[model samples]
Target: MKKEKIQLKGITWGHTRGFVPMVATAQRYEELHPEIEIVWKKRTLQEFADKSVTDLAMEYDLMVIDHPWTGHAAAQKMVIPFDDFLPETFLEDQRENSVGESYASYNFEGKQWALPIDAATPVAASRPDILQELDVLLPRTFDDLLALAQKGRVGFSLLPIDVLMSFYMFCCSSGEVPCQNDEQVVREETGVRVLKLFKSLADHIDERFYAKNPFKVFEDMTQHDEIAYCPFAYGYSNYSRQGYARKLLHFHDLVALKAGDEPMTSTLGGAGLAVSSQSKHIDVAVDYARFVASPEIQETLYVENGGQPGHLRAWKNTQVNALTANYFVNTLPALERAYLRPRYDGHLHFQDHAGDVVVHYLKNGGDERAVLAELNTMYRESLAWEGVHG
Candidate 1:
């Protein structure tokens, strides 16, 4: 009697640098479990944003979903909770800090919808040689970043969604809630200040220098050496693995507001694996999910393939440590402290509105008060939809 072959199909959004390691790991898993055939369907983040999971669920057995999508997916009953299928040992072996207990970013409504596949923290990537040529110290505050932008040598990238999230972090650090009182009063006081800061940076820097896509910023940093420093999402150890090797780009942990301001904070980002509720091959999918969470696979795939390990233990591997070096040492601690975005089903809609507000304020030079008022209205509508105030 021969064992039956299991074919697992998956869909992932975002073409971030993290994909390399995941694809590599899938190939390795195929070698080990010859009976398991894995097929991956890739989609741009925009394509995923344009469609709902319900429309695409039948195409893939496993989906690499965004953190914000979990609530919506769960509400639609599109994903299966892992508690019923995954073994206790599998959960026990996961990096304690990286799993549900410590990293609560991936959990919602007391159920774990997905296992974190990679970890990302926003950091500043700079051309060390350019900085040395300019003889400027690493920026330690948003004010310092503004100064760098003013020099007309260093550039800043403008990403609407990330900038809005970063504004949330800034406001929270300042002890102000952008969405306050169970989403009743949309407080734009803190939001306005954050946008003002961003506007100042934009005004000081050459508009031509702002890159819309982060990958373009990375490429410019490596190829043209034009940007001295720009805020970026971390976990690109794989990109640095080749070509320039050790000399290309340097990673700086996030910058705080000021010396006395709260510690710098960022949102937890990157993809995670979720089993589809509609899949008939639930057992095989669960096994594959467990295998993805294993330390051996995480270590080999994450480090060799350029994906950031969602397992804290894998982050401690000697090779990974050497590859990431101080970058991880300085950044992972921050990721541990990072906060998650709103976990409501309408998170995407809220993010879209917030992003539009940021972009509008930056481009049109409006009073932060008006923009924030509009943002608060949007948040209220989103909360109404989710039935969760605030």
Candidate 2:
């Protein structure tokens, strides 16, 4: 029997080191299953957001979606559940830490909506030479980090989401969970506290010294050794392999706010693959999703193509662990502890409001209380609007 032609459109937000492995894996899949043609819909993260899954689902068979958007995508019924199609053995084969409970980030309404592709968290990456010169230990607490920041010797670089993850770390350290009751409700006090801590850090951040893009920051740290410490996504290991930094610095788990508070928690960062409900080729799409999730593909992709595999087993592979010197392998357990951002249908609006709060306080030294109040109001209004719309 002739193989039926299967075409899949996969979307990725950016062409970054973090995504190289998955993209390579897709290419390999095409080679193995020649009948199935996979076309990548490449876009910057911002462009991906602007295009929206609702629009893309109409055009694509598969989508690589951000984890925070899982809830919103399911709420909109833009993607279909692959739970029934995904084999139990494939799911069972994943590393315990990588797939089982950690997979909860991809679950919505008691159903598995997507498969983890790349899992990460913000960690402190510093130049070993710089730290040696400063005679400072890897920062253990926010206060220790702040002291270093005050010395004018430490240069900090952060992504917009890094600011939020920093906030999550603070809130979790303060014994707070951003979401309550699994109903997509953010605790106002937790949000406020997180925001306030972020603002405090912003006061010390030397804006002029920081790099605007993450890759640039990695380059600065590795090439020029310009930055001493940065809150970088764990995926930096891929960049490190490119000979940007010569093992001069390493990643330290995110710092906690206080000694007795909850352990330091960073935000869960990365994307997942989901099939569009509108696709006619559901079986082929499901097979491709599982293939990408497989341990062999995950391990090979990460080791050869620089993709960060979301499977725990892939993370534990001797070859893969050796590839990047167990950077991500050492960090996966920590990444599992990371929190996710607010996932509402109005997530974009909430992110904008929260980002504004961060900018106001960080850039202009705005009052934390007032900013918190404004954020709380925005959260409430957005949730209400979502409820009415639903």
Per-residue error for 313 in candidate 2, Å, reads 1.4
- Please give the TM-score that candidate 2 achieves against the real structure: 0.87
Q: Report the error of model 2 at residue 336, Å.
A: 2.7
TM match of model 1 to true structure:
0.90
lDDT (Cα) of model 1: 0.68
- RMSD each, Å: 2.9, 3.2
* Cα error of candidate 1 at position 307, Å: 1.0
Question: Backbone clashes per model, in order?
Answer: 0, 1
Model 2, 229-326: lDDT tens per residue? 77544446665453535544566666667765444766677667889999999888888888887777777764577676678777677777677656
Candidate 2 residue runs with Cα over 4 Å from true position: 1-5, 48-51, 92-102, 155-160, 181-196, 208-213, 232-234, 242-249, 259-263
lDDT per residue as tens, model 1, 226-295: 5788764533554444463434666766777787664567656766788888888888787887788677
